[model samples]
Target: MVRGIRGAITVINNEEQEIIKATERLIKEIIILNQVAPENVAHIIITVTEDLNATFPAKALRSFEGWTYVPVMCSREIPVPKSLPKCIRVMLTVNTSSAQADIKHVYLEDAIHLRPDLQLTDRHL
Candidate 1:
């Protein structure tokens, strides 16, 4: 069955390097935690806060081997008041045998506050 893995990370700044590095880190962590293979990934959708316009998060994935062929899209997140700043989020649609409750969702840096209930412990991954 196809499952969706969610991940988000907060960037310190809107700099291109910062955005790229944070995005790569978030994606890598999600992949590692979920044991997601590129072949099993149907597509990825990334969103960034309005404050983050330095670069598209999907651009960072292109640098990884085997990710070039993966379908990726980037967009701006809904600008809610008092929302987290400089945040980048991703939803990876992947084919996995695991049940929905068994999937690992990654929330890094300050983004961890966004999903306290679903947040992972150190040993979870």
Candidate 2:
């Protein structure tokens, strides 16, 4: 079976360093919570607000301890009025047999408020 993990993080600013840090933190947490293997990760699609194009969030994964070849891409999130600013969201598709109830979804920092029903696991950052 295949499962999808969704997560998001808020950037303190539009700075490259902040985006990279936040993105790395979110991806690491998602991977850990799901016990995801690099090979099992089909691909990761990420979206950032238009205000955040200075850096690609996928680069953060490249700097991860043992993840250097994971396929990652970035795009602009749908712009809407009164939406969260400096937000980067990711949808990860991975091969797994686990049921939805056994899967973990992460919403960090301000993003936590996005999914109040999902319990948070320990954060890697």
Candidate 3:
């Protein structure tokens, strides 16, 4: 079976380091929460808001020891009017046995506003 785990986090700046850090943190939390193994991840799609263009968000995954072979693509998010800024969103497509409803979607920092219905008690990770 195939399933997608969605995640998003906001960065304090458009700088490469901040974007990379936020992306890494977001994906790490999603992996921990979902108990996902890198080997099972089919691919990852990372999208950044229009205001953030320092670097590709996919660069964050390079530091992961087991994710060297994982396929990843980075792109710009559609610029909607009055949308969240400095945000990075990720869609991790994986081969999993879990049902769709069992998948946990992570939204951290200001990005939580993008999906309040999916937010947990914690503010950010």
Candidate 4:
């Protein structure tokens, strides 16, 4: 079955390095938590807050050898009032045996505030 795993993270600045680091961290957590292999990933969609245009989050994954064959795309998030800033979010679709409720969705840094109900542990990269 195809399952979707979601994750988000907040960056400290709009610099290319910061954006890349934060996006890498977020994707790593998502992959680890979901136990997803690159071969199993169908596609990944990433979005960043309008304030962050320094680089595309997908660009960071290029350095990961496993991601070379994975399909990935990036776009700007909808500008919602009072939304978290410097946030990068991703929805990764993968072929998995896990149930929807069993999937782990990661939210890190200030982006954790965006999904209080997930009650994820406080972890920083």
Candidate 5:
């Protein structure tokens, strides 16, 4: 059985290093929390806010995960008025036997503010 997990974060800058670091951390947490195997991951789609076009977050993730052949895509978020800026969002489709509720959805750093009902302190990864 495969499932998808959603995670988001807000970057302080458009620097590649910052995006890479934040994405890696969030992705790692998602994988660890869900106990997902690398082979189970079908594909990943990452979107960065319009203000961040300096680099593709997927590229950094591919490098960090050492997944040279994985299907990854990057796109720009819709420039909606009054939307969260400097945000990097990820939608991961993975093959797993875990329930939806068991899948950990991460909202890191300032992005935590998006889901105030979630217990950020419950993050174990």
Candidate 6:
């Protein structure tokens, strides 16, 4: 079966390096928590808040070792009024046997406010 693992993070600015670094950090946390392998991944869908267009978060996954072949996409989030700003969200689709409820979704930095019901601990970083 395939599952979608979601993760989000907030960056300090819209700069390329910061966006890339923050996104990579978010992906790493998801992989670590869920024990995801690149070979099992189908595709990654990344969306950034409308304010964060200075860079594509998918670039971080490309630079990620062993992720070169994994399909990834980037888009802008619906610009809803009062929505979180400078946030990057990722939906990782992977071939996994784990049940949907068992999948680990990550929220880091200020993005934690997006899903307090999930009860995720603060990221070590």
Question: Mind giving the per-residue lDDT tens digits that candidate 5 earns over 1-125?
Answer: 77888889998988988888888888888878777666778999999898887777886666655566668899888899988899999989998877877777889988887777654577775
lDDT tens readout by residue for model 1, 1-125? 99999989998889998999888988988888888989999999999999999888788897889887899999999999999998999999999999999998999889999998998777342
How would you encode candidate 6's per-residue C-alpha lDDT over 1-125 as one tens digit per residue?
99999989999888999999999899998998888999999999999998898888899987788988999999999999999999999999999989999998998889989998775665544
Candidate whose TM-score is highest = 1
Task: Give the Cα-based TM-score of candidate 2 against the true structure.
Answer: 0.92
Which ten residues in a row are the worst by lDDT in model 5? 59-68
User: What's the lDDT for all of these models?
Assistant: 0.91, 0.86, 0.91, 0.89, 0.82, 0.90
Lowest lDDT sum, 10 consecutive residues, model 6, at: 116-125
lDDT of 3 by residue, 1-125 (tens): 99999999998888999999999999998988788899999999999989999999899999998999999999999999999988899999998888998888999989999999998775345
RMSD of each: 1.5, 1.5, 1.4, 1.5, 1.6, 1.3
State every prediction's TM-score relative to the real structure.
Answer: 0.95, 0.92, 0.94, 0.94, 0.89, 0.94
Question: Taking the candidates one at a time, how many backbone clashes does each contain?
Answer: 0, 0, 0, 0, 2, 0
Point out where model 2 deviates above 4 Å.
121-124
How far is 110's C-alpha from truth in model 3 (Å)? 0.2
lDDT of 4 at 123: 51
Candidate 3, pairs of clashing residues: none
- Compute the lDDT of residue 15 as modeled in candidate 4: 95
> Model 5, residue 39: displacement in angstroms?
0.7
- How large an RMSD does model 5 have? 1.6
State the local distance difference test value for candidate 1: 0.91
Candidate 5 or 2, higher lDDT: 2
* Model 4 alpha-carbon drift over 4 Å, by segment: 122-125
